[model samples]
Target: MKLYSYFRSSSAYRVRIALNHKQIPYEYIPVHLLKDGGEQKTSAYGKINSKHEVPVLEDKNVRLSQSVAIFLYLDRANLNNPLFPKAFPDFEKCFELVELINSGIQPLQNLAVLKKLKKDFEINDEQKVQWIKDIIRNGLLAYSKKISDEGPYSMGTELTAADMFLIPQLYNAHRYEIDFTGLEKLLQIERTCLMLDSFKTAHPDIQPDSV
Candidate 1:
């Protein structure tokens, strides 16, 4: 198995944490997203992933894009550590958290979207930063209200894939200097998750391609 990743990408960071937590071994291929006018946009990478995004997992003959799909595949393929309950409401609940971050927060403020805002609508740095801050704050606020308080993890005693999603989004939140004065629950979760080896090794600061 192989993972194509870009350091500082929140989406890729989630997958890294999941892979480490599951103790799955895979070769790391760093795809420099910003180097040489964006490496992901190159003709070469396009052949591998038409979307030109990171967190693309290649195992045997199956190549997958999108972090949620890759994570679900990883969980099913390696059944020892399940990320969520297999039953009805419990399973559905986990996906709700995943989509909260995956769709609600991540897509609106990712690199491509930010650049598009600048290029197409001509938004300036101040506007772009504010845009990011608003999305992070709103999404995190909703998450803080929805999650179980019994946790160091979002879903309670077990560290589900929600933590995998939350940690990276928190990293980005801190990266952009988003204020967390009212988000105490999220702060506690971040503090608790960093104590784990999985999240620590998966952090952007420790990645080989970090610069």
Candidate 2:
């Protein structure tokens, strides 16, 4: 197994955490997203993932691009620690939280959208920061309400793909200095999850290509 990743990419970071949690060993191929005008834009990497994104996983005869797809693959292929719930509302609930970050907030705040805003809309840095803060604040508040009351992990006692989706978003929050003021639930979740070795190993700062 091999993973093509970019240090500091929230998508890749989550995949790393999942890999570590499952105790799966794989080669880490670093794709520098920022150097030389973004290596992911190059034709070579483009063929690997036409979407021009990191967190691409190649295992046996299969290759995957999206983080959620990779998570699904890893969960089934490994069979050791399942990332999704086996039951009804729990399964739907997990996906609800995943989609909340996967599509709702992540896409809006990703590097591609920020670049588009600066180039086309001519938005300044302050405008970009404010836009990020407003979106994150609203989304996180909703997350605080949606998460289970069972404590620790997002879905309660067990860590699911929802937490995988979440930890990275919180990392981005800190990256942009977004305020955590009223969101004690999320703060507590972050504190609890980070205490685990899986999250520790997958952190952006410790990656081979981190700079």
Candidate 3:
């Protein structure tokens, strides 16, 4: 198995965490997203993932895209350590949390989107930074409320894939200097992730290609 990844990409970071948590061994194939005008846009990577996205997981002949889907595939296929909820409502809530981060938050302020904002709309760095801050505040404000009533994890203290989703988004939040403030539940969840070897080892700075 192999994973086509960019070291600093939050989406790729989620997949790396899942792979580490499962103790699944795979070759890391670094895909430079920002070198020589974006290698992810090159024909080589485009063939693997037509969307030209990072963190494309290849297991044998099957290729997977979308960070959440890849994590689900790994967890479901290998039950030694499931990253999903066993209960129906809990599972639903987990998916809900994933949606909050992956769909509601990540897409709006991703690097590609920010690049587009600057190139097409002439948005300055300050404006771009503020836009990311707004998204983080709006998104986490709602997530903080929903998860606060739960356990240490996003849905609870079980370390589901939702936790994988939360940490990276929080890391992105920190990049914008947005204070987490009174989001105690989220803070607790973040602390839990920090204590885990999976998340710690998979962090961007420790990655083999990290620059």
Candidate 4:
């Protein structure tokens, strides 16, 4: 197995956490997103992933893109450390947290969207930061409300994909200095998740290509 990834990418970070949690050993191939006109846009990488995105997993003959899909694929392929808790009541509840980060918050605040805002809208750095903060703040608040004082993890005691999604988003939040005034639950979840070795090893700062 191999993973083509960018260290700073939240989506790639999600996959890294999942991989680590499952204890799946794979070669890490770094694709610099901002070096020399972005390596992901190059024809070579483009052929690997039509979308020219990071976090593309290559397992034998299969190549997969998208973090959520990769997480599901990894979960299905490996039964040892399942990403989703089979015994949990209403699996959708756990997925709700994952979707909140993966679909709702992540896409809006990702590097691609930020670059588009700057290039297309001609938004200044200050405006861009404010826009990102507002969107993230609102989304995080909504996500926070979903956690019913569940203590450690998002769903419950056992870590799930929701925690995998949360750690990277929180990393992004901290990068932009997004306000976490009333997000104690989410903050607590982040704190707890980071305590685990899987999350610690998957962190961007420690990755091979983090700059």
Clashing pairs in 4: none
Which of 1 and 3 is the better model by TM-score?
1
For candidate 4, the per-residue lDDT at 114 reads: 92
Residue lDDT tens for model 4, 128-168? 99998988889889988887575678877778888898889
Check candidate 2 and list the clashing pairs.
none
TM-score for all predictions? 0.98, 0.98, 0.96, 0.96
Give the TM-score comparing model 3 with the true structure, all chains together.
0.96
RMSD of each: 0.9, 0.8, 1.2, 1.2
- The worst-scoring run of ten residues by lDDT in candidate 2 lies at 134-143
The residue-by-residue lDDT of candidate 1 on 34-120, one tens digit each, is: 898889999999999999999899999999999999988998899877877677887888899989999999999998999999999
Q: TM-score: which is higher, 3 or 4?
A: 4
lDDT of 3 by residue, 1-211 (tens): 7999888899999998899889998899998888998899999878999998898999987899999889778977788778778898888888898899999999999878999999999999899999999998889988887783667777765888888988988888877888677766787788889899999988988889899
Model 2, position 154: C-alpha lDDT score: 90
lDDT for model 3 comes to 0.86
Q: For each predicted model, how many residue pairs clash, with residues at least 3 apart or on different chains?
A: 0, 0, 0, 0
Candidate 2 per-residue lDDT over residues 1-211, each given as its tens digit: 8999987999999899999999999899999988999999999999999999998999999999999999999988999888899899898999999999988898998889999999999999999999998888788889889998878889999889999889999999998899898888898999999999999999999999999
Off by over 4 Å in 4: 87-89
